[model samples]
Each structure stands twice: as C-alpha cells, then as structure tokens.
Target: MRKPRDYDSELKALELKARQLKSRRQSQLGELVIATGADALTSEELAGALLAAVTTHDHAMKEAWRKRGAGFFSGGRPGAGDSAGREPGGAASGAGSTPPPSSEPGAA
Candidate 1:
C-alpha cells in the first residue's frame, strides 16, 4: 500500500513546484532577450541563431516551426513585406545589426 501524503508536506511541495515554475519562466525570458545581441538576419536568420544555441529540435523541424511562427505573426495582412521573408534576431542579433529595410508595398 502507498503511504498517504501529509497535508503539510503536500502544501510545501506545491509551493516548491510553483517556485520552480516561476524561476523557469524568469530564466527563459532572460535567455530570450540575451540571445539576440546584434545581427541583420531575416526572421529565419534570427530563429536559426537561437536554434543553433539549443540542441533541442531536429534542423528540419526547427526551420518549419520558424516559418510557421512568422506566418502566424504576419498573417495575410498587407505590408508584411520582407518581414514575411525574415525572422527576429534570435541568438545572433547584436548591436548595429539591423534587419534589412522592409519591402512592403507602401512601407516608406
């Protein structure tokens, strides 16, 4: 038979779990901001940079996800332009590294 969990211990464990989740969120956001430093990469270039930093996903899948994500943000709205062709600066963006000028119809 399994031992019943004590209420006090259970509450403590729940609190610990919450703390862990919060810590993870904080680190993730920090990492995200830090990843893009300087670069003129298109959206795809940015994602490629981030993807290079982590050994999480297969190359093909990562590219596919990046493509899908860019589409989600731009949608079919007009003036999407080069944004449609690029991704944000992931791990490669740095100071002075700006994306190319947008190529939308009327983005002057």
Candidate 2:
C-alpha cells in the first residue's frame, strides 16, 4: 500500500514561502523609495505625491512621465534626455521652460 502524503507539511511550506515573498516585496519598495530620494518625505507626503502623479489625466504629461520612468529603469540618468524627439518642457513652452498648467480642474 502507498503511504499517505504529508499535506500539513506542504501547506506550512507554502505559507512560509508566501510570507517570505511578501517581506521581499516590502523591502524592494523601501529600496525604491530611497533610490528616488522620496524617503525624505513623511509617509503622508509621499503618499499624496504618488496619488497626484497616478491620478493625473493629461496624456502628454503622462507620456513625458512614462519616458522618464523608462529611462530610469533602463539605467539612464535623470535629465539625460533619452526620450528622443521631445526636449525637456518643450511640449508646452517655446524655450524648454516649465509647461503650462493643465486644463483639468484641480491640476497643478
């Protein structure tokens, strides 16, 4: 006759693996915060800033941010202009100055 499987041990191992993965994810997120220099902000301030960025609806603004983020992930330094064909702030201003305010209400 075949022996019974140790289901309890298997369940315990799976639970431990899940906990380890969750801890690693939290650690990685902390590293990202520090890398971005956002660790200087209070938790509330960081959360608010992230909320604002994520909730922005301007397509051009989102694209600009996307390119910057991609560059960061691709090991390109910030402000390196890797986002071909678009000069920094050139989309909104003639002299690469700050972009104009979005038409969206409550946008900064």
Candidates' lDDT values, in order? 0.56, 0.66
List clash counts for every candidate, in order: 10, 0
| TM-score against truth, every candidate | 0.36, 0.60
Best candidate, lDDT-wise? 2
Predicted candidate 2, C-alpha RMSD = 12.3
- Local accuracy of candidate 1 as per-residue lDDT tens digits, 1-108: 998869999899999999999999999766544333323446686677677758655888778867755764566422323333474532233223333333443466
Tens digits of per-residue lDDT, candidate 2, 1-108, equal 999999999999999999999999999999877654456567898899799899999999889888777777778754223332465532322322222223344473
Give the 10-residue window scoring lowest on summed lDDT in candidate 1.
89-98
Best by TM-score: 2
